[model samples]
Target: MHEAVLGIEHPGAYSSATAGTDTTVELWCNDHCDLLHVGGSEAESVVAHVEDAVGVRERIAEGDERLLITDACLKEHGDDPIEATLAEHDCLLVPPLRYAEGRKWCRVLALDAGNLTAFYRDVSAEFPVVVDSKREVASVRADRPLLTLDSALPDLSPRQHEALLTAVEMGYYRIPRDATTAEVAGKLGVERRTFEEHLRRAENKVVAGLAQYL
Candidate 1:
């Protein structure tokens, strides 16, 4: 299978919400509504902007994060141009689509490289697109296990997940430690003690969950 990670310059509520903010939005869409997971320091504002821009059906807050159900699907808002184009070339979009830095990032899969290339060409003709990464997988079964990690790991609270991700992203776990707990806390707009508590709890849960595999 041919896999591609694409960055598309498409304007919509998700894109607009992430513009000029540290927020990132990940969403899974269905025929009825879209389920969005929003995070970062500006998460609340991002959610508000999305609600105003596209209207939300429901919203549930989780610490500094939010889970929102959109009133309509992306197809209903005419934001499925890329999906439609991909279908024309027999490509599949892997969920959940991510929005950050004012753009849409999608993972697409195609059985043939030719079809993948054709899909990219057709979509790029309408929207500015960047091929972030592309590769051919030897075995779909081999990669399928990676996708199941979410289920294998114990669930962390929204804050715990954010704390862990922020720490990793800041290189706090690097060999020499590129960042300190205080620095990570500042980035998340939280106290150092709070961040440490969240991170430690997350680490414990993750370690315990993976003990069997180890």
Candidate 2:
């Protein structure tokens, strides 16, 4: 799976917002870091939606359905307990990690809508503080360029085009945890790493080509 952008120290303690309802939640997991890894099949779509908002909550997918894991939540909780709560909600947890070694921060992946992170107030400072750095959410790279990629060729290039098209076909952006990169790449006769590189390069080219818009 791809890593989200690493923000400040801990992303949990930050105040969060949840759309939809208390049962199915979608919220922003944005933080202070600049680099972000969007690994899910719908990472692109998620990023696109995230761009409309301040953060990306999580994702969900199914076999060939490309189910959209709609509904995210921004909370004031930590990763583990929140994830555990999500599990209680029938959302599978991907992996969990402690980010900075302060024993209070980490990041993990789960079905987007199923994410239930914990939050605590950072009161050690002068005033109240909210944090969500570990969520690995990334703001749209406004610096992305779109000029290099030919509008005609946007649909070309074996590697890049194939990768993007495949993701779309699989509804990676739809959500609900569809097929994984390995799953998609395997069917396409390419390694997941190769596919990812193609996608990364394709994204860079597109960003470069579209830089003027920003």
Point to the candidate with the largest TM-score: 1
The window of 10 residues in a row where model 1 has the poorest summed lDDT is: 142-151
TM agreement with the true structure for every prediction: 0.69, 0.28
Predicted candidate 2 versus true structure: per-residue lDDT over 80-152, tens digit per residue: 3444443554433232222221122223333342232322222213223234433433332457422122222
> Candidate 2 — what's its lDDT?
0.39
lDDT of 1 by residue, 1-214 (tens): 8888898988887887787765778889887888988876688988887777667998889665789998877667665677778889999888888887788988888999999999989888988898878888665455553254454686565577889999999999999999999999999999999899889878987998899999
lDDT, candidate 1, equals 0.82
* Reference-based lDDT, residue 52, model 2: 49
**Clash count per candidate:** 0, 53
Against the correct fold, how does model 1 do in TM-score?
Answer: 0.69
Global lDDT scores for all candidate models: 0.82, 0.39
User: How close to the true structure is residue 65 of candidate 1, measured as C-alpha lDDT?
Assistant: 72
